[model samples]
Target chain A: MKKIFFSFVMSFVAPMLFSQSYKPVQVNFKPMFGSQELVLNDSVYTFNLKDSVYIETLKFYISGIELLCKNKMVWKENNSYHLINLSEENTLHLMLQVPKNIHFEHIKFYLGIDSGMNTSGAQGGDLDPTKGMFWTWQSGYINFKLEGKSNACATRKHEFMLHLGGYLYPYNTIQTIVLPMPAKTSAIIVIDIKTFLSAIDLSKQHHIMSPGNNAFLLSQIVAKSFSPWIAPSKK
Target chain B: MDSTFQKISIIFFLLVLLTAFVWVEETAFKIPDNWPKPKYDFTKNPLSENKIELGRILFYDPILSKDSSISCSSCHLQYTAFTHMDHALSHGIGDSMGTRNAPALMNLAWHSNFMWDGAINHLDVQSLAPISHPDEMGENIVSVVYKLNRNKKYRHLFAASYHLSSITGEQVLKSISQFMLTLVSSHSKYDSVMRKQSLFTNQEKNGYALFQKNCSSCHTEPLFSNFQFVNNGLALDPDLRDYGRMKISGDAKDSLKFKIPSLRNIEFSSPYMHDGRFKTLNQVLNHYTKGIQKNNTLAKELETPIILSANEKVDLIAFLITLTDRQFLFNPAYGFPK
Candidate 1:
């Protein structure tokens, strides 16, 4: 009688524990600065703008990642902020843990640090002040950083640096991006920098250091530029 | 078996009681009565006597700067309500002039934004501005951390306060914030009157009425300032070309807007305004009545001229003097860690 009762308990408890454990899903991000794929410091890509421009540096934050199934959030990564640098290839891939049996139909994330984190004191890891993404002059993190040299720019060395970040209303630079996931467990999301740069008149509005209308507009464009690649899964 | 169970229960109860005692002793941030809840969320960085003492030491230490000559105290002196007296703009390391005046520091826990432009939204990270500014400390956080780690004094303090093996930039910043958070200035003559502990003089009473009629709209009561960014009709400084809040928000509408400073220690924290343009209360009153430069972005309240007679100005100045909290200005606890 004792053995039978023990077996019955194990049958229910074992599956419960197994269901609690999650499977790791790896998502790869590919950043393309125009028609060509982004290669930091390679200087092979040209701007989609009218003038001849070379892409040198492209780094931005992707944070608050959430997995949604049937329009309901199934899982969300804690401390999901990631800083993706075009020069660093390893940062392009992110592994997110999700419930084993749940089917995640969509992925949602912010292009910049959320206001809650921004107001909170100095944080560690990707949000650390040591990272160049943080602005010492201001308290907030730089959401998107795009630096390059262009013939159209009138400044010395023909350089343009756009450090966009602000958490206030009317000039809030944080942008939310939602993408439909493919049937595969793992998928690639392409961030086409061409769509963002093409929309901006770089020569006229090259230097965007502070948060404002320009930063807000650029953030919106960048948020819309991300799409899920439907190619066959490697696994 | 019952005896054994009772003994174990007694031991557990004693342990819990001891832990609670220690926790209460460590967390001792008291909110003053009749004041709004502080804007700083203290749950993330709990206050402790050791951490505050460590922070006080850091605030006075020049080692945080590139050259070990300039400290936060150099620009912010406690006696003069934590503002540099007799300087139009803040003088930084090596006598470098900052574009804006170092505003008085008091009641910082109530403040959500820092600097004249409101660039820094959090008090915890506000110190980073002066620490890394080329004209200010001219020292990076990486170097500051390295310096702190090498110093035996800081290492010992960090171990005692944070129980960490090594010093970190976050620790330094948060410690300073803990110290700044304790600077609550709620013991002025105005506070006495508000609490009905004392009566305001006839002149002060009249001035309070006038202040309510004119300045109270922006400089709200209890805290004495609403702490919003508003263009107060000061002409743009041609040399500095500081667009104030506009530079941070990138909005044309926010041009010339600066954070409204608290009037807790107005007498000591002068010359006034973002640039320290006014040397006396008389000048400030005169500007409000006569010197308002009309512009599109000027505060709507100031657009209609503030009418103040010479006698009324004197009365207003008298009321402003009531805001001086000598107790806070010379509080030994807030003074340099000896």
Candidate 2:
């Protein structure tokens, strides 16, 4: 009985003690609007004579993060789900624990919550239903949410909303993003909101607020808008 | 040496105390004879007495509504098999009405999908729909959680059940699910006859035979539902024009198809149908006999009209009345918490 008792205690305490041996890797996310850092509601970006947008709410899930070396698996974050909200400063950065001497050349992650987690019952932390990313009338996470005002829209106050998510077959909007980068203690990735907006025909798809074909297509465009942050100089 | 001996004795006493606390906490949920295992994964959120009690309180509390004027019980009263007695379409706060009848809450753990359209995929998250619907509670889960956090009684109850200081959306939804999952109705006369504990009347026997021939394919026995979405040939109401499953699936073939509800406790749970169009058992039987509106999406069994003599219809209703579990309807355990 004493042996069983000690083993049970060790099971939980062992993980907490073991994980501290690894070095912490910082992954920073920089939300960009065209050539500048995107401000919540104060900044406006104009794409054309009739198209201008000011983002009011921007939030999405970054999940299932993995690091690869020589096209092979190296390290993976356990329970890796992050809800990145533009309005919250601290949430924009993720600290990943990695082995001190582990080698990696690529960082890969999913742009939304995976299908398994979608069907699984209530989740906590970043995947909490109270976070406003979950659909109330249905059962799936809103992978990408963007609420803003656009000049192209004719609705009340010219506002637009796009909530992209679907876990079922044929309409699964979860996208995988893999990028080649040098391994370091810290790295920055830019989410270019301007590129995503320009790629869309604003007049037609200004209000894709549900999971469907439009959300699936728009999710592909969202995937292409991401890139490693470049340092601009000599302007 | 004396101190070491004392420490071991104290540890043993603490372990005994913990065991007693757990022993008194959980009330075992037993599966009835010859019933299929429940689809709900109880291991994830195991049932406990305190959790179920907390859930019962939340189920009756009107704080979940927008104006604090209605609750889950407003539409689903316990005596009437947890369904609104006379309201055709469900009523909400501020005198607003919903588009469909409020579905009865019984034998829920057997169901994988919820709603007339199967919009809700899981039982744990099903509360989100009515809570946020414009015509129903008209309240969001975020606001509900915020309200729960501020309430002293709810917070104290939550802490007892989950042992968490702060209440969360997951805890709130899971606690409600625990209560709903416990509402199992298995002690009906139909079940007693099936188990050979009682003999069915000759009229009920004839009705059972007729039901198996015409209705058992869809409203299968044991659970009394195949749990499929089908077009039962009710013509669309032009004002509401609900396309049912097609709205969620976006498939043309799934148009006008709604989930087949279980017939358990059918005697008390009325008016019938998704829109609550049928007022009595006769109206519903007559619809199947003569009122089918033929469409491409109609059920295969309904392609041939069910011919029932007037006397046979009475016998069929007599058998249906045998499905009412008086114990389940009157169980104080499922009633308002003290």
Whose lDDT is greatest here?
2
Give DockQ per model, in order: 0.36, 0.66
Model 2 regions lying over 4 Å from their true place: A1-8, A11-20, A233-235, B1-4
Q: Please, what are the lDDT tens digits per residue for candidate 1 over residues B1-338? A: 99999999998898678667566547667887889988988888889988898889999999989998788999999988899999879887888989999998988998888999988889888989999998999988888889999999999999988778998888888999988988888899999999899999999999999999999999998898999999998988899999899887667999999999888899999989999999998999988999999899999999889999899999999999999999999999989899
Restricted to chain B, the TM-score per model reads: 0.95, 0.98
Kindly report the docking quality category of candidate 2.
Answer: medium
- Clash pairs of candidate 2? none
The alpha-carbon interface RMSD of model 1 comes to 6.6
In model 2, how large is the Cα lDDT of residue B24?
81
TM-score of candidate 1 to 2 decimals: 0.84
After aligning candidate 2 to the native by TM-score, how far in Å is the CA of B316 from where it should be?
1.0
TM-score of chain A of each: 0.85, 0.92
